[model samples]
Target: MESTSPMRLSFEIRQMSPQQKLPSPDVGGMSRSARVMALLGLQYTRPFHRDALFLFFFALGPAVWLSMTVLFALQPSPRHALWSPVFLSVALWQPLCEELLFRGLIQGHLLESMPKQKTWLGLSISNLLTSCLFSLAHLANHSVSWSLLVFLPSLCFGFMRDRFGSVYPSILLHVFYNGGYFLLIGSATR
Candidate 1:
């Protein structure tokens, strides 16, 4: 009276919608290591396009530097030292690594379970949570105030990651922000 063949079961699974086929990785269905690998392997490249959001972030870099100058008495340091290893690390290395870890892995993993709805000023809950962790990570090498300031930019990076479905844009923005921030604010690392 009932069909229990493997073919029938496979057909039934095929009939289900994508959303119904399996649980999200963060929904306790996947092992921790498997989830980490899946998230890390998520799309890291998207066709480059200067969309409005990208333009907004690009312009915000200068504005941020100016605000730091006026608000925190941050002096613009000499650009002659721009070729130093520390400058290279902040501008290039750190952005790539941070974006890969935070946006590519952590936020991507969170998005699997969290609703995509914009909860805070167009940011998803995943972005907010990732930003908090990002800021906390900065506290190891930065002052409390400096670390807190990292939260906003972390949100921006996460937003770009979600919007583009890739980590490339986030990395670019991170580099732009860090290079300018260190150049203007003198890398106030503790």
Candidate 2:
């Protein structure tokens, strides 16, 4: 029988037996908005731990910045600061959409559908794929360097999603990353 109950979804990657597959999300009875959100990887039912979130902001953020800076020598040099409301869109709104779509929906779907195979140390093949796609998606606006550079942060976002069992922390990290980078640019250039 087909089930139509609106049920919760998990964004975390679970360790499963070799031949085992993940269960599909329960979206039958869900509201249209919820179903849409679920399809995009925004599972509201998952838990969000404080430790994970704090790590994303404080510990992981600076660590990532420093590492990327050393690896790519990235310097945020903004031409000028826009005091208008659009800054929020660049820093928060756009990042929210990106994290929801990339880490939340696309990566979340990969986690659900693909077999969880350890690619390296602890990175899953699905996560590696998602990060590749996420980085590739940035090819147009950013320079080739930046496009390739994005993979690192994208992977971090995926890690946050998996660690926290939800995309909320990833979303916040995205916001923190974008906002801080742009702010640095504005302050440095102006």
Name the best candidate (by TM-score): 1
Error of 2 at 84 (Å): 2.4
TM-score of each: 0.71, 0.67
Error of 2 at 158 (Å): 0.7
What is the C-alpha local distance difference test score of candidate 1? 0.70
- lDDT tens readout by residue for model 2, 1-190: 2222222334565464443333335777889987666656566444444453436454556565555454443555444554446567777888898888777778777776664554343455666888888888888666677777678788777766654446777787788776766554433311
Give the worst 10-residue stretch by lDDT in candidate 2. 1-10
Q: What is the lDDT of residue 123 in candidate 2?
A: 50
lDDT leader? 1
Candidate no. 1 TM-score = 0.71
Model 2 TM: 0.67
